[model samples]
Target chain A: MTTETKPGVREVQADDIAAKVAELCQTATHVLPEDVVAGLKRAEQTEKSPLGKQVLIEILENVDIAKREMIPLCQDTGTTVVMVDIGQDVHIVGGDLHEAINRGVSKGYTEGYLRASMVAHPFSSRVNTKDNTPAVVHTEIVPGDEFRITVVPKGGGCENMSRLQIMLPSRGKEGITEVVLRTIEESGGNPCPPLVVGVGVGGSSEYCMLLAKKAITRPVGQQSDDPETAEFERELLTKVNALGVGPQAVGGSNTAIAVNIETYPTHITSLPVAVNLQCHSARSKSATL
Target chain B: MPIVKKDGETRATPPFTDEDIAQLRAGDHVRFYGTIYTARDAAHRRMVQALQERKPLPMDIRGQIIYYVGPTPARPGRVIGSAGPTTSMRLDPFTPALLEQGLKVIIGKGGRGSVVKKALQDNKAVYLLAIGGAGALLSGTIKSMDVIAYEDLGTESIKKLEVEGFPAIVACDMYGGDLLLAGKEAYRDQPALGDYVSVPPAEKAG
Candidate 1:
């Protein structure tokens, strides 16, 4: 389908994308990404105890070692999550969209030395999907002809503690707070602290879950630009750290690094919420095509 | 509890005195003083079944800390590869029963259930949470590892691991200050005030 583009916008190339995706995959595991490293540095400086600061330093050093030595950041390696934003006019000429994404993930993980962590089932056998296939692809058709892709590696630890709730429409912010607090409180140290909590508000059940997951993919310390939503992030961040699930939850003071909140115009009848926790490794990054 | 040794064993068991444990605190890098035994979901099943039949355990539990790990097969001449802790929550069901047989220490990553916590307290034992993903760093602490039973369990089999002062963090101690709880409390910078998690130690690891 032909679509409009801005004056400077150009079509995204397949080879460029393949090379870029490979680099993004390798970079995702090897480096902490600028934002996350900065976040850790800030946490280190402001960290209260000598131990928590040391943990943060070790985390920083680990990131450095992976980058320098070209090793997978964590052994878990994580399942590949690809977020694609297709501009109004860009197209993939050589192959099917699904195949292209899968091909990229396969090459990236295999060549990058990352582990394969996908499974084929939900409740029953829970067999390993083997190749970490069928990447969790989120595509958006947006304003210009330039495409962008953000790949996130979601480790099993924090992902296990994720939760979604269908709240009474009347429940609102108070309900959101309760769900968030109870989830972290119950999680204790299982998710592996210090944690970054991502909250999804005002969508149907599934999308709310998606929002929660996407919220985590956002860079640390950046708040939702919407004033109301950003305020919610601040309020949530304060409350979570107050619970004291400090660094590694062995305890000191940095329970949660930040809380990112995203909301959508939802059905008047729905007040769904989802909480997706990201462990300290917090590996994610993006590239525009 | 009587000491039990398997037919193929080639190592001696080393017990730690109360002074040994007292000298250590949360987040200390001590090579584990005693020989640690390996068991995870699969091996625990056999242990439980052996108990039900009133059969002698293939390995003794006295003063032993059973580590919940299924290490990646050692590469070439390596003693162990990336040996880090897995979530202990999965083994929570089998913990108390094992504790009754004198399992004094449980080493793994992540927290355990209330049942396991109470059992540790009741037995005057402890639970240690090692750095979860520092598998390469942790494997370096082990002096040696040898398989003892259920060789067919693959990576999940029972094995006796000979270790020196292994780096470990006391997650839940005998009197019950769960480092998990204290760790959470100490580092939570901007927590919502009502949240009760607190860190136990104010100093960083040396």
Candidate 2:
């Protein structure tokens, strides 16, 4: 079943998308991304405190065990977050797109034996969804004929530490730095440092949060495209490490491995900043189909 | 049983006596070889509720260690999947009551609040820090696991686990020594912010 018969159009089966998402879910959970692994290795070398260094070593060992044993690096396995970029020239056929994604999430989580962490009613009974369904999917329409999907299984601990604040325009970069530092300081060991701090600036409160989430999905240590933003990322990274939260917050110089900042134009009277932290596991994977 | 210290590391099995806990100090690395019970937020809430309602708890938690973990489903032939500690501070609200019921050891990641710390000292219990996110490695330490109660909560179910050489650090000891705070204080650099920074003795001479 094809949606479009026009020239220059590519028809992608929704079932195929589900299969890819399912595969990605398992792989992302079992394997730590190379960039994050490298960041941890670097942290292990630079960490000062004995306990902090030992924690980094154990984390690296855990990464190895998960990869070798084909198991999740962390038990939380987390709420599956799917980011999809659909080309205008590409048509999804055979099923509803959102349902297809959720199907993939459920199948991957259940079949792969990952934890079912999502709860049905957050503020009520809080029953477990049982299959880790209803993934948070963000979709974008791009200019090409390619459909790309990125799966991020975000854990509860670090996600709980994320924060967003809408400040007066008068509070500029210094204010943003203060918020980020304070968040990191307050978080301490809970988020499982050394962390990858994602900073989103300039959008609305919600969009800023999304941007911060997107920033963390980028490869660790990859600077922003904007020159000024890249500089800001460096500055924030220096300040964050200076906090001496170190690996697992046992205390040393390696508090955060990277600070990725994403910014957009915002209203004149508002300065919205969101800080989303990714723990040491930092699991994420992508596929283009 | 009392804790045995050898080569600067403490080793112990469960059913910890007050003497065993008193032997532990903040920052002491411990390796356990015995039984532990697993429970997190949901199970803790129910247990606390049971206590409040004057109903008996499903399991005998006295002199027991509670590991705050909800592991993934184990694959065929495996004892458990990646099983690691969740954040402990989330269970801070329900902790004191558990301590009151003779809960001796709490194992998880991160620090606890002041009230929980005070409770730990008052009850002569200890808080141990398991390496967070090291689930796969931690799972290797579990020799076996069984659902003891609250099976309906799925992974949040209370499970009794037999473990061997399970490693952890004493984050908060019975004497009120707190490793998380002590670690940060020892390594934290002088504040860069003028308002928070103290004038160093060397800098004052300038």
Candidate 3:
């Protein structure tokens, strides 16, 4: 391999990553972006039920409280997760990326009053991380000095309902629609209706998961740039709302406010799609620096 | 789905005894009227531990129904804040223990898991599922939490509530009957006209 060095590139320290993570945790939890707030307000208008309408209003108020007090919106607090998109021009210095992330998560959770939801093991002796350390960190190296960090806290209910599946290409649009509709129907009002439906399409298993999650950050009602995929998302949206799962599934109308789909080209032999359901709580915040 | 106000008059299931478990069937539209306790995952654990140790329970669970809920903390002078049923699956492991201590009814959103269904069958208990995510509306049914145990656990702490006409659906009955399956079966592409065998209350008591 040629050891070609690009001049003037800066190296980032593990401490820098840690500090950034910590700050992100608190800031994201406190301030919801203007786009999201606007989307929720629009959703408040669209929700039909008297109870559902009231819950949406309370959510708006809760965000106001969370921002004003710099505390978490819900008691569930949530598991700490950091998604970092780093510039290729920079090199990390001082320590491991993972450790820096964990440290930042540790400091942030402790100082922010967010709950520590991580467990040492999945099966036996489920233990709390206390300070919500050891976050689920995802890193991607891309183009400029700007590193973007999105700190999202997902509660267990919506997390439990997330699903991924592989389908025969022959099933095509119709089959995929069925799977997605069935998933939401079976989910009922449990995922906290009027949810942002994140659909990941045309990837191997893991890529589908990444796409599904990353899809959330796109502004609440925006569509995929790909026309064909955007059309598919629109189709899924129509079918899902038709189920009348309503807000909280008590029944009325409008189970999901919107369905967003993100897809990529894949091998002819394989077709995979995943769905990640996010509740109205949709606690997420990001910083670009 | 029709809307019913809090103070509206309707058919209700008054507090019943252990023997009354045999008289309710799954899928029965129910409106619970009485004092019901609220306990979710953590409180359920503490309650079961108390029962296992033969220690005094925080409240009298005999013939009492527990609403699996962890409500948002009540604001000052407002009886209670958003209170709604959480998923029932999380409390399945602790159910049998509480049932052994005479726990008769468990209410929540989702249907009970296998162990909870088994416990309900063996203990002659019933499971009622409230509407999920209707927190604000559900809270209106609860007058107040008369007593709260384990204050430090915050929302998950045990709460003794006096409710009047809390609406819910009978999800699972004691005689191995299930309503979740029935409802889905009855609902179809054209508006379901499906049928399923159910052990009616009269058949159950006999």
Candidate 4:
């Protein structure tokens, strides 16, 4: 099909994108978003265990220290994840979109003093990708002429706990809830609770996992817009808190500050559920151009 | 309880006495002073391999504390990047071997496996939890650091770090006192604020 030039589709250089991603990665790792900081403060106030409270307090103080000193919030610095919403009308100029994103990752990690966590091969060599390059990128075509990008720096400790399972439709909500709870229970204090649990329900297995990941990047404590989904989220949250897993898995009442659920249409016979938990850090940021 | 401030002289380190570790209990806040070595997955594996091969390990393992961390690169004038604990569980398989070599103390985040806990008991060691996400604040406590071995591993290299007032909590004590479990049990009966679910009826209830 012959393409027609649009009257107003903006042209954005790939280098600009690389620079932005680099900056965003650094910012996301170093700075705790205000919402996450608030969630932690709330956890501190409500935690019943004295030790858990102390931990929360220290975490908040750490945030302040990291901000003032321009240090990363956590040592892991995390695997760089980029989610781009490309404007369908706009044409990206200069270089390959994906390569540009990777370049940005390389610059961000190296200059930001972020840890290079990526291993070259999963099973064999396992060499470090020194500059933390090859970001995991997810893209979507959206309506506007503006390009939007979000960078989520996920800590390895928490990411290791993420789980996905295919459930028979017969299992339904209870099964989904059970898996989510089981994942958290298995996680214990490992993922650094007062966690943000992002659950993906329906869709295909891979897609559901993606949804779970995307859900974690949402603002902590924000719930689903769908009333039923929102209610389910609250119910699951209550049960998870009831697990008494508490902050840092150190135990207390405030195990998780929020549970965000996202759903998509799926095969009629399958219920693919994925649980992605974010530690108290829950670092992420978005920029639009 | 507010964090118990542990400072000069009280901080645990090399030359750890039973008295030093005995003074600690699960849930107690500690400010680690003196020196600790940094090691994580790769370093642990190498250490274990050296033990199996009966080869000399990089550093003397006796009465030493190891921090499970792979820190970001140091920026200009900074001692290190955000240096926080990685999950300890990944180091579980190699831990017992290290403990056998007289590894006395461990610092990291998360629950350790039962096998490692058994090792802690066998070796009379303790495990402490640094505030997991508080790398920035914790970085302040680090006075100096130098990679002593396995520099090729990059961030995962074993390094010698001297820290002052490095705050942490005694997660697992020498007597098998597990703070992670104890902390959970501390509030097991209590419902946190916003916990709307009521406990299920007791099984004995008619």
Best candidate according to TM-score: 2
Q: For each candidate, C-alpha RMSD in Å? A: 7.5, 6.7, 10.4, 6.4
Ranking by lDDT: 2, 4, 1, 3
lDDT of 1 at A136: 81
Q: List the global CA lDDT of all models.
A: 0.71, 0.88, 0.68, 0.83
Quote the lDDT for A28 in model 3. Answer: 63
Evaluate residue B194 in candidate 4 and report its C-alpha lDDT on the 0 to 100 scale.
42
For residues B1-206, what per-residue lDDT tens digits would candidate 3 score against the true structure? 11122443333443556557776777565677768888888788887788778899888787778888766545456676556677787788988888887888888765567888888899988887765544545666788686569876666778888787687766788998876555433322311110111112121000
- Chain B TM-score of candidate 3 stands at 0.82
Model 1 Cα lDDT, one tens digit per residue, A139-250:
8899877788887878777788999999888998999999998998888767767777889997788999999988887777677778688777877877777776666666
If you score just chain A, what TM-score does every candidate get?
0.90, 0.98, 0.91, 0.97
Kindly indicate the candidate among 2 and 3 with the higher lDDT: 2
Cα distance off (Å), candidate 4, residue B4: 12
Tell me the tens digit of each residue's lDDT in model 3 across A167-216.
Answer: 89888888778778888887864676656788888878899988888776
**What lDDT score goes with residue A102 in model 3?**
88
- In angstroms, how far off is B59's CA in candidate 2? 2.2
Question: DockQ for all models, in order?
Answer: 0.24, 0.31, 0.07, 0.35
Please say which candidate is ahead in DockQ: 1 or 4.
Answer: 4
| Steric clash pairs (candidate 3) | none
Error of 1 at A201 (Å): 1.0
Q: Tell me the spans in candidate 2 whose CA falls farther than 4 Å from its real position.
A: A1-4, B190-206
Q: On TM-score, who's better, 1 or 3?
A: 1
Ranking by DockQ: 4, 2, 1, 3
Error of 4 at B100 (Å): 1.4
